[model samples]
Target: MTEPDPPPAGVAQALYDRRDGRLALEVVDAPAAELARPHRTNYFTAYWVRAGRGTFHADGTRHPFAAPCLLFLTPYQAARLDPDDHLHVTAVRFHANFLCVETHHHEVGCNGVLFNDPYGPPAVTLDESTEREVADLVARMRAELDTAGLAQAELLLSYLKILLVRATRLKRGQQGTAGGGVRLPPPLPELRELVERHYRRLHAPADYADLLHATPKALGRLVKQHLGKTLTELIRERVLNHAKWELLHTLKPVKEVAREVGFDDELYFSRLFRKATGMSPTGFRAFETDVRGGSNLSMPSARPSIPPPPPTGQNADRPASDPPEPGA
Candidate 1:
């Protein structure tokens, strides 16, 4: 079956179109009506809520939020903010190519901790001081955004890195053992990083076990003990997540999407997708478009628009010129 044309560019593009597809920042006292309904974006988002209260939805999970909080949304993660009218929010949205977390994971660990985390609340509750610090960083970013300096993009990237680092620290603190007691297993962080880096190519728990230098049995035990799921389950979740994103965002054929996610056999991939999501990939793609608006199917673009890679000259695993933290 032929796929339809992609949906219209979202509000972020409306805000950043003149910037030539790089980054956009805005302080929103009022969000559009569509934001209250579930929607996904093609860029990463960070929302700092300054006041009021509401429930923030991510991937069908509802997280309650109060004032002075930080919320994150990765690309293609379905999210909605049912926020009160008085809510004040500072929103930062950028394409993956603009500041690729996959490229700079070693420098700032926000990709796993803040954005693509499958285990934690997408919203981080902030203490007063941390909130103030992040607000200052956002303000600095806003300042750089307003001026057309030679290093404007670099300056904004620096501020963004610092903000991500600060949020990572806070998120780690929040996930620390309750009652200030038990130490988490040391392998957990590396495990998450490995999964994020290699999930596209490695779908088996044993593959991750070999990379970690641990026996498959031992690694599986650790994952189940800490994360409450078997290691295989975790790996599969990551693969399915990427597959779903491709289905929603790209016009790739089902076979191509399957292969992109490491499934060489399209039929097997379709079976797995059906088992996990209760629909075939084609059905899911059509359903996503239909719900977003009325069905007006059109021919796919000649060149399918896949998500952007890490910026040129940067290694996928690590960048050579990882920007320094703000005030560092």
Candidate 2:
């Protein structure tokens, strides 16, 4: 199918409570044109593509999706849609402060499964039953958003929680079914957890292997077999994710950001960042800021007329960068 034309340039602000700056939650029946362009949001977003056949691009992957699918995007994750025909979408957005996805990870299990799992697809295909349930939940959320009542925020949050929980459950079921109900090896899961905890300080796979009580070579082979990436690559990706978050969300110098991510040599860090993302640390910040019109609090009101430069080399084949945190 042919991709739709891009939208014109403009500013697009996300929904947020005017009285409370920290509380940002909105449910909108977004226009197709608004989504046809690459943009980033300060809040987490989920698009319920009610009726559409197109490619959904997020981070650096192109996810071709049809109707009755849910596409997820983390904060500052650049994304766009290209529909073959008319596209109907409803978007639900909420900042971390509004729902604290990490805090509710135990309840919904969406922190990595739905949002941040680098190895997983960014789009989830929903079955008929799951679609109906999600639609009902979204409708209730829309109704609550429109009403001005006591404890409205609490009620809306409950609905959002249910929606996330259901989606996570469906995704997990699909994963298990696809893998013939086989679970990952013990150390693989532990490696991810350890990377999340120590990516800033531990740059070597040997460090993780020691922590997991496995030989480095055995653990490395396991990672390559299951995740299709080297242990070193996994650790580097985690470190880069943190660096991206810091570069976009803070005014910290590139050197400081590099140091925070365990790199003492700023030049080496910049070289690594550029190779992975197709842009230097400084260049990335500048380009993204320009794209957002100097604010990461909202998506472009309109899509940029000029397309972003296509990534080159190794990055061209895989997701090269992580979803950055929103800028203050």
Candidate 3:
């Protein structure tokens, strides 16, 4: 027989947050010996195990399933569900647009995609005490579902946040199946770390070279060689990225934006933003506010001048993109 259709999107749900978005709670009881290819759910989902057992094939490996084990499947992963016995599955699905509106929110890729680690799928198995917390959150969700009113969306968000945090803390998995995980490179991944830590400072090239204990010329040469851009380029990209985020998301003033990104002078920040983005912060925000408001956040008109590769962990905040290690 042909496989049945996957569950409908947003079934058993309603509009909330001024009808800005919706969420679904579903209970599935099934008995199927074998299954077809792994299923892909475009919307974000968190599946909690209430009863029965099954094995999940995800992130290129099989994760054994038992009752009370929670799985956090991120957007765009393929997973196969096969029940060893019958299956009782409780799931929550929410649209991304409600979380943050994107023009074409349903579009294939999630920008600002955080945590691309699949072998890094969050698996948290709840112990008895923690399971009660999970149960309480679910109960609240069930109660929220019963009432129909204006504030339900905000209340739902509150409960969902509680459940997600609790599940991540209690059940998010600590181990990946052997050999299914990606290897963090042998050398320390440093440049990205530097960017991550000091990007907020918006330090200049010379500052970084000093921190890395190398001459500015050597650092520039090494960075361009590995990362294909000069040190000046990396700092600007991060500063600009943060600038864009604040412009589009927060109503923070121009001066505050400069301060947050380490530009003492609002005028300098405006100049730098224009150089990188081809527009001032106000113009950038106006553009995004026009399209996505929460809809269309603008991208750098030019590609990152120096898109440094992940740094070697050895030199905590330096880029492997920089010159070879002295010992090496």
Instruction: Write candidate 1's Cα lDDT for 32-85 as tens digits.
Output: 355676665545788888887887866545567777888888765556788765
TM-score of 3: 0.43
lDDT of 2 by residue, 1-328 (tens): 1111222243233323223344478888989988987676657788999997897766445567788889888764567888998899999998765665654678778987787665555677788998999999999988887785899988998999999988888887766221334667676766777888888999998998999999999998977655546788778766876787677667888999999989899999998886555457886666554433334323333444335566675456544354333651
**TM-score rank, highest first?**
2, 1, 3
**lDDT at residue 254 of model 1 (Cα atoms):** 94
TM per candidate comes to: 0.57, 0.60, 0.43
Candidates arranged by lDDT, highest first? 2, 1, 3
What would the TM-score be for candidate 1 when compared with the true structure?
Answer: 0.57
Q: Is candidate 2 or candidate 3 better by TM-score?
A: 2
Q: In TM-score terms, which candidate is top? A: 2
Candidate 3, residues 90-181, lDDT tens digits: the string is 66655443344133324322222211222132345666887788778777777777785778877876676666555544422433222223
